[model samples]
Target: MTIEQSPAPSDVADVYDGIGQIYGSAWGPNYHYGYWDDADDTSSIEVATDRLTDMMISGLDVRPGQRVLDVGCGIGHPALRLVRTGDVDVVGISVSHVQVAQANELAAAAGLAEKAKFQFTDAMDMPFPDGSFDAAWAFESMWHMPDRGQVLSEIARVLRPGGHLAIVDVIERGPVSPEGRKVLDHVCENYAVKSLGTVDEYRTALAANGFVDVEIRDISDNCNRTLAVMADAVETKYDELAALVGEEQATSLLAFMRLSAVTPEQGYLYLAAVRA
Candidate 1:
């Protein structure tokens, strides 16, 4: 396979727009849920994502009447889930127009038309006022962001004082060898991820941006297992995905899945974090 270079915003946008189209259909609804146990069974997408969403929500401690923002909300699944609490107003933002449209449709269907909505916008340039939200969450999407610090800064800017931010994503870890880096770079290049930082890197950024009470949780096992199961699922639906997104994209996605299985199996990593 030919390896590509680091992705631009437009490049990432195209990849995710396609992902948004087949996200629920191919991934089975957990929308790339993180893993706690590499061996945990992910046969059931509903169960896997449910556990993942619960874990994420628990960290945010979202309450009724709170204003929440979901940065990089894919199809607004988590935002929809958050509205079930009956006390939160949620706005999901995505760079992909397709995802925003789909998410809005899903939100409307779930009867959360007023409380939860998705818009097509960049996280680094969100069109919201300062102190606009009580909490912000980024589930498995920050890694895909090219400028995470800027995104974090924007998040900090929009959050109310002492507002919470919860993120569940893959983080790079110690002593990455040349080979390991190559594997990671290959996956990132093919899939259009600009960069993925370590857990400490994130803490430093959060602190630099004036965030406190930062917590990083090791969920590599969960990520690994999810990737493994998802690989199988993708393979099972390879034909359909190719039909929807073409062969090159489908192959690239499989390469992404195969790489995730390798990273955590070889090193320790944090898959999630919550900060105030």
Candidate 2:
């Protein structure tokens, strides 16, 4: 599936440009789910998300000075963490111009301007040349892309032979019941996601794209707390969110978050594959 070079869907851009700051304030810099080691763990969202980031980085096994690409990098926090932890140079890309600008500014302020750079680019049609990166990671970003296969293909194309790709994304476990589908639909619509694919689908796409050593680990239980935390954050900032994005949007967003937290059929997964 080839995605045209036209601008991304307005929902994708608008969601970020409009309430990105507010969302970031609630969701933290990772903008993704957290991985808890223990079921009873009561860590902050930032700490838990950092744990998830560290897991992805470990899977990538990057080295100093190696170039890494961050697909759908929001606010560049995870990319900056990679620079500090692995001494890797990172190029982060996002469809949201607001995020791109903010990410670059954050990188500069953190004294990582040379090490971590961000650009307004799409995952389905990245701007970089083939074999440009040693490693790449998409943290909960693939669901928003119009075509997961095309996005994975692009990731494979930009990665050097033997380069690794690590991803943490929401996945559909199986055919959902009618009630489950309703909740799934609401989450997708509000989140600007096209659809959630299955674990087997992801494995097949990776293999078809010339990626090897594919490993998928279901970490849904560990990551499910992210939605719960987000729901609480929304409630805590209910009026502020309503003021920022209007009452209807805020209400819908909160409902989506709360419902998604309890929906068991929709889950999360961590996948790692190597460009062959």
Candidate 3:
């Protein structure tokens, strides 16, 4: 299966706009992968997803009264958490019009309309002034970027000098076997992902974009349980998702989840960097 060489904003928007709610229902507020502390940690999906957000918050290390750019923000729950955590203002952007409206409503309902705002914007070409933000984050969204470097350059451009950036994402750790390639292909095809980058590529991309003091953490083991948990969640909500997104997408989601759940090729990592 061939996904676009570079994931277009429209393609990404169509996919999320159609099935954003299904993800919320199955994966809770955040659309990114959850983090499990250990094999013994039996936290619920909500707790695990929140845990990942908290990790980003720590990595961001922004102070009160600062501004954060939430790149590819999905429905704004993570932005709400970040705003409430440090009393910082967050500007979240998403290509999906449906998600931006829903995200704004979520913020307003949470009494965070003043602190958190969501807009329909593409990360590849964000319309923001230079040095507009103190910190930024791209959560599970880079997978959809056709040119991750260009997106990183935009992020770096908008952020102030010394601004910190956090990215909670997945990567290709090493060469995958034929069996794993099938899983990766299905995931990229069905999920509207363009391609997976290796850890070294990530470093090179970040550094090239004027990011310094990079810290890339490999937390795949803790994050691997997400696909398994997601599989169960999707299975439980298959009928509802099928009704919303059609039978074909629902079936593909299940197959993607089933395959990714057992595949170890996808590595999860959260990286932090500071603008020089």
Candidate 4:
């Protein structure tokens, strides 16, 4: 029988809706994306999460007892981590129902249920009143969004005056040579992703959306190191992970990892920017 077509990016949100459990089984608790350390250290989930969090707070300067929002928070790791600082109320929103449920479960289990909360909601259409938060963060999830501007605008709408938004995301670097563009296009098609924007494009969008103090930090080296580490780790765990996800998915993941390792080398970097 012919295989049914994979869903579009809009549908992708729904696809990941229940994938939080399988999400970590393939990689780890950090969702297995981006660089973990800026000092060229070995990359890992724990390191990446810490690095991203630091970038968020330092860049946005999150204040104690402030209300924060995490767009596309996978499994609520960052949100829970922020809560631990005893200075923020983090509201994590994701299109993935699975992630939200697991995040909530984790938070409640850790007795952080009151300080951190997870919602199954779209980033472009968040459910909150105006000036709902003092700060916001999006870690490596911006590329998954189709309308980055709309998402940013929504984020701005929810943020109070002088509020900050920090985003740690993957952005394309340099002009894609026509041939290289073809290769990238092939990868995007295979993954059913609609698009990936460049660093300049994201900065432009943030600016056009009325975000000030936009900055682009080149952390490609960090991502490259992390990708290499993950490549090695996943190779060793392939068999066990395959047993968990079956042969086809395991193979897909391997291909994905290999491609990602090469992609950053080609011209991709973890970009952290802020709005004030």
Candidate 5:
């Protein structure tokens, strides 16, 4: 199978630097999906996103003093929450300097600077040493990677034996209709996403890299709400978004929100595995 490379780092950084501001204003701090317990649950998007983060944290089985790595950490919200909830220190890495700066500022402002630190680093070539982390996670950030296997290899290398890894990402579920593919490609264009990974790809990659006890499951039902919510937010702030990312790119994003809202082929998946 041929996995594609990610967009250029500069391109990816530009994409996030603009969208991050929009996301911060619209969807609170977290840029990932929202979770709902069931049809009756009506938690706000901010709370739902945190719930998803907590869900990922729950699977890590981390200890208080262990270090955790946050791959493609957008703004360090999850890292900060992890330190508060589990008393673990986090070292978050992102390609975007804007994000690293903002995340560090947030961590400092929250008095968690020593516990959660963000840096501008590429996951494909992590600066961390072998066995540097006790646990790791990528929250909806894997798709931006140019080389999925390289990033996973780095994750595996940095994590100590018996350390747990968790990942939550959007994926191509299966057999996307041509029309759906068209929308998916358009979303990729504006979002700086090269390609989405499949569940089987993850399973194979994890096993090949000496990970064990891998478990992956679908969580789309809980996350699909994020698209519509984001669309609503973009619409309400279209002028502001246009100012940040220009009217053209901002319009494409809004259209993606509408199109991808009904695109069932785009699904969310969660995977947890232990490093061996």
Candidate 6:
């Protein structure tokens, strides 16, 4: 019935620690949105999410033996895919200790412990040296950052000159009406996100942090179907989710998921920039 005004890193981590596996089972390894090509496209969510990952990897322009930072990496599945595709080394960081441990286990099971490793680290204050990585990837992670600019600056600092940063994030399209704002607020609160930023705002922050050749692509239409799929999954698993988290929280989460599925004001975007 009552929502926390602002959730801290620990709060977010706790939520993931409790429901990470269940969430992964319902949504699969890739937690981000899926890309749908057409109304009749019947590709599975896993395939579409992999397509999005491939798109991000292409935007990054990474090569073999390069070190890439996977910011806010969820369960390290995307990082594993990147290493497999490009033969690159990836260091994934997450706020949740459970995620880091689970990701490491998954990496070991896939025989990628040497190529892809995950650690419990905050994106706002990453534990990496300057120019340590050749490229960076942030997938659906920026919205949880309390200070988006600070996080961007940290990513820029860790990346080498000319290194690319590719991000696929949920964004606010523009000014939202009161009704829309209510839906957005509920979604943010339920998802442990501090706030949503506009595509322009993301571009400006990247530029301010010494990033150039910024690119922003609105992919709302392609990704909106993910929310609908997620909502249906939640509805089917309502009892299980309620048992994990309280009934009130589960009901509220289902409401937010359904609203997010149909809301036009909340959108998705793909952004890329090169370190200047």
- How high is each candidate's TM-score? 0.87, 0.94, 0.95, 0.83, 0.95, 0.95
How many clashes in candidate 5?
2
| Tens-digit per-residue lDDT, 1-276, candidate 2 | 122332355678887776656777777778888889878898888899999999999999999999999999999999999999999999999888888998999999999999999998878887799999999999988888888899999999999999999999998876687877887777676667778878988988998899999999999889987888888875777788899879998888888777877888789999998999
Over 119-227, each residue of candidate 5 has an lDDT whose tens digit, in order, gives: 9898989888999899999998898888788889999999999999999998887787998788778767777788888898899989989999999989888788889
Q: Worst lDDT window (10 residues) for model 2? A: 1-10
Candidate models: Cα lDDT each:
0.73, 0.86, 0.88, 0.68, 0.87, 0.87
Candidate 2's TM-score reads: 0.94
**Lowest-sum lDDT 10-residue window in model 3:** 1-10
Tell me the tens digit of each residue's lDDT in model 1 across 32-87: 56445345353466676766777777777777899999988887887888788546
Clashes of 2: 0
Clashes within 3 Å, all models in order: 6, 0, 0, 3, 2, 0
CA deviation > 4 Å runs, candidate 1: 1-6, 34-43, 243-256, 265-276
* Residue-wise C-alpha lDDT for candidate 3, range 42-139, written one tens digit per residue: 99998999999999999999999999999999999899999989899999999899899999999999999999999988888988999999999999
- lDDT per residue as tens, model 4, 1-276: 111443344465554542334445655666535555456455456766576566566766777789998888888877777777646899998777778898999999999898899987888788799888888888767767767888899998899878877776655555566655654565455443456667777778888877886767776666655555565667677666567668897777666656665664234444434455
- The per-residue C-alpha lDDT of model 3 at residue 202 equals 90
Candidate 5 residue-wise lDDT at 267: 85
lDDT, model 3, position 219 = 90
- Runs in model 3 deviating more than 4 A are 1-4, 244-249
Please list the residue runs of candidate 5 whose C-alpha ends up more than 4 Å from where it truly belongs after superposition: 1-5, 245-248
**Decreasing lDDT order of the candidates:** 3, 5, 6, 2, 1, 4
